[model samples]
Target: MRFTLRQLEYFIAAGETGSITHASERINISQPSISTAISQLEQELDTQLFIRHHAQGLSLTPAGRIMLMEAKRLVEQAESLYAAASEASEEVRGQLNVGCLTTLAPMVLPELSISFMSAFPRASIRPHADHQEMLLNGLHRAMIDVAITYDLQIPADIEFTPLVDLPVHAIVGESHPLARHSAVTLSELAELPLILLDLPLSAEYFTALFMKEGLSPNIAFRFSQPDIIRTMVANGYGYSLANVTPRSDTALDGRKVVRVRLSGENRPMTIGFATLKQLKKSRLLAAFATHAKSFISDAYIPGMVAPAMGQKKR
Candidate 1:
């Protein structure tokens, strides 16, 4: 075939992103290279693949849309063939597209990815951080191979392997009245201002905690980013709930934040790897999954405080 797999891959990226610039960033290739690949692919296929917009980027011609689907299937099959070869040789080597919850990515992925790469020098990982729903969508669409995330609203089509249970904790400024308490109840927290980490399904999970207890939080602020919420809590804006507590009892701005265990019956979120049920694990994916299982647990969660002893998994 005149068109190479690399060309097809570029076409897929461009078709998905709708922008050569975005596709280049997605695949870590130069804009010129992607542009050249797409142009060449269209030439080889003897058809116009995309309608070029002056500045708005490219839109797939109906033909481009059709090719994208086939290209993805071809690429997946190629990857599986390579994975089988690697498995036969007992060599874990390939690019793994890994997704993680945005909240967990900073604390978990860097260390886990670095160590995993160090252990298997032949392997490389590309990390994508997004909300739970987006991550799941990525898994279904084959945009990501696996996701490191919580067992929150997990759909049946995805399989989650539990590694650790992270119990929720209330974080507050050092001077906050409830900060000195050994543990605080949902009722007590409901009375105070709550700085909510408001991200898609994550927001639902946090709010559900309050709903389960028949109490509504006195939400003072809503922020999508966790660090901002931590900072807001540290500066005494309001207390916030979290599963993964930072090892340092301070926010990015160096303000002290205290993690007090949530008192009474509350569900702890299980951290684990999620993959599509139907997708066979590639050798690189399997190796990474094994590494993740070994690396993350109750005793040790990279860049975060270990789960408190005697914290029962729900």
Candidate 2:
């Protein structure tokens, strides 16, 4: 079956946006054109790519999911080839699909993204913010070139390079008693109600901290978004644990939150890049890794505190 690159681009836009209309708007093409491209691609492949819903957006079938992954890789590769051909400079020129952890997106990604884009003006960088599981899935499926995230439960097929160690901080409301303290202990925090950040691997990390002290936190509320958890903690709902610390103490809702150091031998989470193990490192990927390391060393990324000047835990 012969499928044009234009068809794959339209299909990918629709699959990513989950709607033909949105894809049309995103790509500045007519809805009918996008629809026709999708239909032709599906007919060529002789398989259904999407489950159409009347009045609602479309959903990818199992085959559609597989196709989307391959389509993204192909589209990106084609773009890279075009970009390289258009520019004959010494600098590397290609597209990189980067992923960042949802919690770290606001704190760590923007500056690095801008710097990378600026350094390699000929190349394109597409960034996606998601949780660890989704980021890992994207990496496995070749949808994401490299990911900026914590050293979570990395599969054997993935490679992780640690850049900085972020120790967990205990967050509480300004009015809370523990807020005035410079540091708090797990056992001390265990007595208070906990507002858990119940993300896939993060929840386990926070819980394990308490378990090390032979105590279980009295979980009062649980949230997935870090900002929501911060807002709840600022509203005096309960104390929370987090590795990423915003530069400002104020929450999104204009409430004040305090960050206190955790007293004890709590293992710090390593922030790093994750990529497929056997995948060849493209020039774009190598450049990104090098710049990321330099950025951490230069202390240029805002809201991300530098690793403490002490012996790190192995």
Q: Which candidate number would show the highest TM-score if scored against the true structure?
A: 1
| lDDT: worst 10-residue window of model 1 | 305-314
Q: What TM-score does prediction 2 earn? A: 0.82
Which residues of candidate 2, in runs, are more than 4 Å off? 1-7, 20-52, 59-77, 80-90, 298-300, 307-314
Tell me the deviation in Å of residue 242 in model 2: 0.5
List clashing residue pairs in candidate 2: none
TM-scores for every candidate against the unseen true structure? 0.85, 0.82
RMSD of each: 3.5, 4.7
Cα TM-score of candidate 1? 0.85
The lDDT per prediction is 0.89, 0.85
Number of clashes recorded per candidate: 0, 0
Q: Which candidate number would show the highest lDDT if scored against the true structure? A: 1
Clashing pairs in 1: none
lDDT of 1 by residue, 118-194 (tens): 99998888888999989999999988999999998899999999999988889899999987788989998898999
Model 2: how far is 211 from its true place, Å?
Answer: 0.8
